[model samples]
Target: MDHIRRLLGRVTAAALTLLGVSVLIFAALRAMPGSYTELVLGPLATPEQKASAAASFGLDRPVAEQYGHWLRNTVTGDFGTSLVTRSPVASEFADRLPVTVTLTVLALALTLLIGVPLGVYTATRAGGGRGGAAGRLLSAFGMSLPEFVLGSLVVFLFTRYRLGLSVGTYTPWSEGPLASAGSLFLPACVLAVFCTAATARTTRDAVLGVLVEPHIAAAVARGEPKGFIVRHHVLRNASVPVLTLVATLSAYLLGGAVIVERLFDVPGLGSYLVDGLDRRDYAVVQAGVLLAATVFITANLLVDLLSGLLDPRLATAAKGAA
Candidate 1:
C-alpha cells in the first residue's frame, strides 16, 4: 500500500512538474526583449506582413491564451509548424527521437557491463589488491576529463586508424543492424565513459560499506566461502544502491549524448535541440524541452518506484518518517 501510494504521489508530482516546466519555458521564451514578430518574420517585414504572421501562428494573442492553446495542442501531438524550417515539428521529432533513444540505450548497456563487474571486483578486493587500486585510479581519471574533449579524442583516435568508425554517417537498424551499431558505437563510448566511472565508484563504495558490517566480518571469520558470501550478502544488500546509481546516471547519458551526437554527426534530438535554439525555431525548442522534461521525470519516477519495491527497508523508513 505504501509503495503504491508513493508511486501515485510521484506520478502526480511528475505531471505537475512537467506543466510547470512548459509554463516556465513559454514565459521565458515569450519574455525575451524585442519584437518576436520582427525576429520571426524578419526586420524588414512591413507591419501588415508581421501582423499576418503573428495572427497566423496565433502569437498575436495574449501570452496566457497562447500558452493555453499550446498546452491543448501539445497534448494532442501537434507542436505547430516551425518558424524557421516551416515544417511540422511532429515530423521532425519522428525522424530524430529514435536515433537518440538507440544511442543512449547502447551507451547505458556498455556502462553496466563495464561498471558493475569492475566495481564488484574492486569491492571484493578492497583490503589490498591491484583491482581496487586500478579501478580507483581509472574512475578518477574518467571523472577528470570533460565529455566534449573526450569525444573529440575518441574521434581522432578512431578516425586516424581507419577503424571502420565511419563518424559522419547514421544508419538505422532497419537498414542494417551491424552497420548501425558500428556508426553509433564510438559516440556511445564517448558518452558512456563518465557514467561508467561514476557507477563503478558508487558500486565500489556501496559494496565496501556492506563488506565492513559486523555480520559480514562475522561470516568471513566463520569460514564462509567467498562466492557464497558475495551472492548471499554483499550483492543482495548492496544492489539497492547500485540500482539507484545506475538510474541516476541515466540522466547524464541523455544530457551528454547531445555533444557526442554533434561530434559524431548523428541526426538525433540533441542536434535538433541545438539547431532549434540557435535558429530560434520555437516549435522545435518547445518540443525538445517538453520531451526532455518528460523523459527525465519519467525515468526518475520509475527509479523511485523500483527502489521502493526492491528494498523493504525503504518502506520501513517511510513508515517511520510518517
Candidate 2:
C-alpha cells in the first residue's frame, strides 16, 4: 500500500512537472522577438501573407486562447502540424523515438558492463594493487574529456586503423545488424565513457565504506569466502549509491547521445531536434523536448522503484508513512 502511494505521488508530481515545462516552453518561444510567422514565410513575405499564415496556425488568437488550444490539442495527441514537415508532431516523434531509444539503451548497457567492474576492482584492491591507481587515472581522464573531443578521437583512431568505417551514416539493423551495430559503436562508446567513469567512482566509494563496517569484518573472520563477503555484504550496501550514479549517468547519457548521434549522423531524436531548432520548427522542438523529458522522468521513476525493491527498509519506511 505504501509503495502504491509513493508511486502514485511520484506519478502525479511528474505529470505536473511536465505540464509546467510545456507551459514554459510555450512562453519562451512566444516571448522571442522574431515572428515564427516570418520564419515559416520567406523574409520578403508581405504583411498580408504573414497575417494569413498566422491566422491559419491560430497564432492570430490571444496568447491564452492559443495556449489553451495548443494544450487541448496536445492532450488529445495532436501536437499541431509541423511548420517544417507539414505533418503532425506526434507522427514525427513516433518516427524518431525508436532510433533514440535504441541508441540510449546500447550506450547504457556499455556503461554498466564496463563501469561496475572497474568500480568493484578499485574498491576491493584499494591501495593494494596497481589496478587502483589505473582506475583513478581513467576516471580523471573520463571526467576531463568532453564528449565531442572524445568522439573525434575515436573516429580518428577507427578510420586511421583502416577499420574501413565512418560514424556519420546509419545502416538499419533489419538490413544488416552487424553493419548497423558497427555504425553505432563509436558514438555509443563516446556517450558511455563519462557515465562509466562516474559510476565507477561512486561504486568504489560505496564499496570502500562498506568494507570498514564491523559486520563486514565479522563476516571476513567467520571463514566466509572473500567473494561471498564482497558480493553479498559490501555490494548489497553499496548498491544505493551505485544505483543513483547509474540513474544520473543514464539521463545524461541519453541527452548527451544527441551530440554523438549528430556527429555520427544518426537519425535519432538528438539529430532531429537539432534540425528542428535550426529551422525554428516550434512543433517539432516541443515534441522532441517532451519526448526527452518523458524518457528522463520515466527512467527516474524506474530507478525509484528499483531502489525501493533493493532496500526493504526504504519500502518499509514508505509503507509506514502511508
Candidate 3:
C-alpha cells in the first residue's frame, strides 16, 4: 500500500512538473520579440494576409485557449504542424528521435561499462589512493572540458590521426546496422567522455567509503578473495549512489546530446529543435521541449522506483511516512 501511494505521488508530481514546463514554454515562445505571423507568411505579406494566417494558426485565439487546444492535441501525439515547414511535429520526431535515442543509449552503455570496472578497480586500491589518484586526474580533465569543445577536439584528433573516419556524415540504418553503428561510434564516444568521468568519480568515492565498513574489514581480515568482497558487497551498496548519479546525469546528457548531434551533423531531435528555435517555429519548440520533459519525468520516476527496490530501507521509510 505504501509503495502504491509513493508511486502515485511520484506520478502526480511528474505530471505537475510537466504541466508547469509546458506553461513556461508556451509563455516564453509567445513573449519572444518576433511575429509568428510574418514567420509563416512573408515579410512583404499584406496586413490582411498576416491576420488571416494568424487566425488560421490559432494565433488570433486567446492564449489560454490556444494552450488548451495544443495540450489536447499534444496528448495524442498530434503536436500540431510546424509554422515554418507546414508539416506535423510528430512526423519530424518520428524521423529524427531514433538517432538521438541510439546515441544516448550507446553512450550510457559505454559509460557504465568503462566507468564501473575502472571505479571498482581503483576503489579496491588503498582507499582510492594510487589508482583513484590517476582516475581523478583523468576525470578532472575530462569534466573540465565543455561538450562542444570536447566534441571538436575529438573530431579533430579522429580526422587528423585516425583512418577511415567520416567527421560530419551520419549514416542511416538503411545502409546496414553495422554501418549505422559505425557512424554513431564517434558521437557516442564524445558523449561518453563526460558521463564516464563523472560516473567513475562518483562510483569510486561511493565504493571507497563502503570498503572501510566493519563488515568489509572483517571480510578482508579473513583473507577472502578481494574480487568476491568487492563484487558482492561493494557494488551492491555503492550502486545506490552510483545509480542516483546516473539518473541525474541522464537529464544533463540531453543538453550534451544536442551539441554532439550538431557537431556530428546527425539528423536527430537536437538538430530538429535547433532548427525550430532558429526559425521561431512554436509548434516544433513546444513539442520538442514537451518530449524532453516527458523523457525526464519517466526516467526520474523509474530511477526512484528502482532505488527503493534495490535499497529496502527507502521503502521502509516511505511506509513509515505513510
Q: How well is each residue in 1-322 modelled by candidate 1, as lDDT tens digits?
A: 8667766887899999999999998887776665557766678889999899788877788988888888999999899888877899999888887788778888889989998888888888788978789999988988788989998888788778887667778898789877887788888888788888887888899889889889899999999999899888888678877777776666555543678888888888888887777666677788888878887887777776666667678778877886
Sliding window of 10 residues with minimal summed lDDT for model 2: 249-258
lDDT of each: 0.81, 0.79, 0.83
Worst window of 10 by summed lDDT in candidate 3? 248-257
**How good is model 1 by TM-score?**
0.91
Which of 2 and 3 is ahead in lDDT? 3
* Number of the top-ranking candidate, with TM-score as the measure: 3
lDDT of 1: 0.81
Candidate 1 vs 3: which has more lDDT:
3
Give a tens-digit lDDT track for model 2, residues 49-132.
999988877779998888788888888888888887788878777776666666777777988898888999988888677999
Tens digits of per-residue lDDT for model 3, 1-322? 6667778898999999999999999999999887787665668999999898888888998999999999998888789998887888888888887778778878889999988887777677645367767877877777787989989987888778866778888888778878888899889888898889888888889998888889899998999998899888778878888888787667656533788888888888887888888778999999888878887778778878887878788788878877
How far does residue 207 in candidate 1 sit from its true spot (Å)? 1.2
Off by over 4 Å in 3: 39-45, 126-129, 160-162, 254-256
Best by lDDT: 3
Q: Candidate 3 at residue 209, lDDT?
A: 89
